[model samples]
Target: MAEANHGKWTYCVDLAREEGRRRTRRRGGFATRAEAAREMKAVLDGELRGVYEDRRTTVASYLREWLAAAKERLAPNTYAGYADCVERDLIPAFGHHRLPDLRPKHIDCWVAAQQDAGRGRVTIYRVVSTLRNALNAAVRSWRLRYNPAKHSVPPKPRAAERTCWTPDEAAAFLRHNAEHYADRLTDLFEVMLGTGMRRGEVLALHWSDVHLMDRKLYVRWTLAAVNNNESLFREPKTEASRAWISLSPRVMAALHRQAALQVAAHPDGRLEGLVFAKPDGLPLRPQWVLDQLRKRTAELGLPKIGLHDLRHTAASIMIAMGIPIAVVSKTLRHTTLAITINLYGHLLKDSADEAVKALAAALDRADAERGASESPLPLAA
Candidate 1:
């Protein structure tokens, strides 16, 4: 650093470059020489560590580049969400900071602001997760010495209490929908109830995937809304999620009606036409499905639930009707049986009681059989 006659300390550094050219980076107007020296030391340390990306680049620009490069690797829906979080929240918070200047405190402050502003845990969690991932990419690329976002902790998301309608309530709602709003919800809701398929899986269903004779259907792809007023058919969620699901007779009958309706609505359309498309032949957006359910539930004066809640209700119905846990787990296409058990453990509480009772009855029967044999045993034995 060199001081002029005015006596304000100035600092300059030869920043290390990842490429051919060394760049001149400078700062000025520090009140004390020690302050300028400290800044100079930090710059030299960062350069020696080979962790500086340019001090000129903002977090927002770097994050956008990182996300663009990451899009091809991330799932369509997942990438879409990451983009949304960055654009809506992360970029706005740290966008102005130079890449090297983004400290852990900045992230900590952002999280605090989010929580204090009444953001939900899940929302905060997603934003934090997205930021962590972006910064992780930066670390891998040698853009930063470490990820500040690793220390960015949002409030832990509490496991949501599953709120679902009982069998009677479900039946009543279906009856109401079929009677009052037949055109909007009945068949789709029935399919979900029967199969317990996820929202994406159900909406992505195609006529060809349905086997009327076998009373089953194959999950092939998911309908995802990745951008503004647009939707795309992407692959199923995971390897486990792509499987044939058994169909109940009610579900089969609904499919039959749906087929007829599909034919009537879009005759001579694509060969693998969507089973649940808008009237204009476009695939239904996930939001549209949610809005329909929300509106219908409000209209019926019933407890409102999302599409996933319907899946949960279906799981309860299956478990309560004596379907095996493993079977239910496979039917729901959970990655692991443990996940299924954890999510629906409350509904399966009776299973433990039933198991104990069953074991006791078996032992009692065995004892009685042994007593009968003892009485029949003669001295010849």
Candidate 2:
């Protein structure tokens, strides 16, 4: 602070690192020293209030922290996805803007820009949802008046119908697998195709989870990355996810064969080690598996799809083959039958069409039997 001149105040704030080095800082000017002091005090108060957050914290900054905390509570691979959104998409657009200053129109405009920039509707929807949730928390805890992100209408996501592999497509993938990555990864793929287990679930498998004697595999956990420094093994996302999946004879056989291979290769045939480990017996990272899938798809000239679609494809194929929906839902370890029906209901509708035809045929047979059994002479009707 500088001495007063003619009762006018002059003051300066030191914006320096903890080590005592000074750096360029934001400055304000006032007419009186006392007034300057007051202004500085107010600014300092606001900074202290937002310190847990950063000074001049914006929607984007707190969102990053919220995302970090949320990531800590989620599985590793899931957190990686959320972080990607925070870094590459959300922060770039709204990082510096204050929360209170944001308006619905601001969010709407940003959403439009993202759509114009070629981001998928689903991706944009997630970005807005993530921001809305973080700001909602701020409103509850941080003196924020409103959640502007929630005030804006979420951009409509384009309808994304599941595209499962057809029987022929599945056959091609299986044949390719057998030819190239046979015995090891091929068996794993077959198990996924047969049981509709997610990639993470399949990879997270342990010999203990595989109840071969009971013809079921317990889906109790999934593999995920929590952060750069750790991989987390987490329970299935939903209670419904923690169910038993009945396996077919072929699937059981494949798993048995896989177990034997693991025994011969891994020390003590450790059933507790990761189901899918690296050649050197380390846990396989999920991204590496995804990369492998992508490369294989490119080589085979097949349309690129997510590993999750393999689960959907398995369910869809079974539905097409006249498997009951409830069984399929259980096999897929879905939380609700509604979810299974929503995703694969169209397949079920097709099945229903066939069922109706068979029902009609039975009714016609009953009518024929009644007419034939009646005594023609019964009377002088």
Candidate 3:
């Protein structure tokens, strides 16, 4: 036993041997030398008896191991995203910090710093969620006694207003698209808006995924761009993402026209795999798509929206038309109806006036029936 006086407490380090050569140093703090020695001895005995093995591993080291095991359970794209989040956002902030010393105050300060660095609430939320889950895994493995993530409160940004183009506005946008982007790009955008397919799903589409005879688009895979270098195909984010979307006549016509144009341009139908590929017949890059959309919107002087806003627009149109929430949820491939409702609940509330009218009509019918019954069934026979 080695005793040292540090700060206000006496520290004792006990050397204990377990099995043949497994040795460990048990450390503890006490007020007096005798008490420190006794506590250290007890901890050493527990260590030898395999009761407590303090995993003195750091947060960074454990995260690497956790990521390795977690990757196997997730899709390739998801794994890549998680890896990016850890490497870019998490490691720089907490990698060197002592895991046991982390506190809620520390997390709050770090989150504020992140916000100061211009990280949006959505990005910060994702980072915090990833960090929390990583720490949670450590807790489950007994590496940690408490999860600091539970104590941290990342700011929640207010939800943005939902804006969807009306039917006439949709037509105007399509007409402008036909006039400006007259090739496969126009068709691809139209298909996305018409079918409510995600951007990745639209990029992952292949000739085989389309069923002209059945007039359906099979959405089973998505194309993800990693590090802006290569595009890879992976399973959709959720189970509900794998579905069949009925193609509208105009959208089907556009796809068919694009197919003919591609066959004519490439001589071999550009059957290089993807339905919406680059001009050189390679997979479309997400950034390139965004660039095109941005330039086109600028040229047309249209309302500027992100690529994802197209998806929101589709969902908004459905909600405005009184589509059932469950159906919209399934169409959007959300994990739950609650998510769909939460995203578009504001729009649904606008229909409340009609709902009140329905209740009033029901009451009127009941009152009319009651009055007839009380009027003495005059000459009913």
Top of the candidates by lDDT: 1
| Candidate 3: tens digits of C-alpha lDDT, residues 247-332 | 88987987888777777777654643678887776888889889887777677567777678788888888888888888888888
Cα-based TM-score, every candidate: 0.79, 0.73, 0.79
Clashes of each: 0, 6, 0
lDDT at 22 for candidate 3? 55
Candidate 2 residue runs with Cα over 4 Å from true position: 1-57, 68-72, 87-92, 225-230, 267-272, 294-304, 355-381
lDDT of 2 by residue, 1-381 (tens): 544455455545554365777643444445656667665665566446652222245767777778867866765666677778778877888887765567788789998888788977788887788778777777777546567887665656766776678889887887898788866677878888888888878888877787878898788788765553465677888888888888888788778877788888766756556566777756667676677777777888887877888888898888878889998887777778898888887777777888899999999999999999987875575
Higher-lDDT candidate among 2 and 3?
3
Candidate 1 deviant stretches above 4 angstroms = 1-53, 264-272, 357-381
Cα RMSD (angstroms) for every candidate in the order listed: 5.7, 8.6, 6.1
Instruction: Give the 10-residue window scoring lowest on summed lDDT in candidate 1.
Output: 263-272
Tens digits of per-residue lDDT, candidate 1, 1-381, equal 556786888888777564898798788877889878876787787778866556657999998998889988888778989999999998889999988889999888878887799988899899989889888888888878888888776656887797888888788878888899776358999999888998888888988898888988999998777773677788876899999999988888788877777776566733357788787767887887789888888887889898999999998988988899999999899999999889988887789999999999999999999898885656684
Q: After superposition, how far is residue 318 of candidate 1 from its true place, in Å?
A: 0.8
Q: At residue 352, what lDDT does model 3 achieve?
A: 78
Clash list (residue pairs), candidate 3:
none
Error of 1 at 76 (Å): 3.4
In candidate 3, stretches whose alpha carbon ends up further than 4 angstroms from where it belongs are 1-55, 75-81, 112-120, 266-272, 376-381
The alpha-carbon deviation from the true structure for residue 161 of candidate 3, after best TM-score superposition, in angstroms, is 3.1
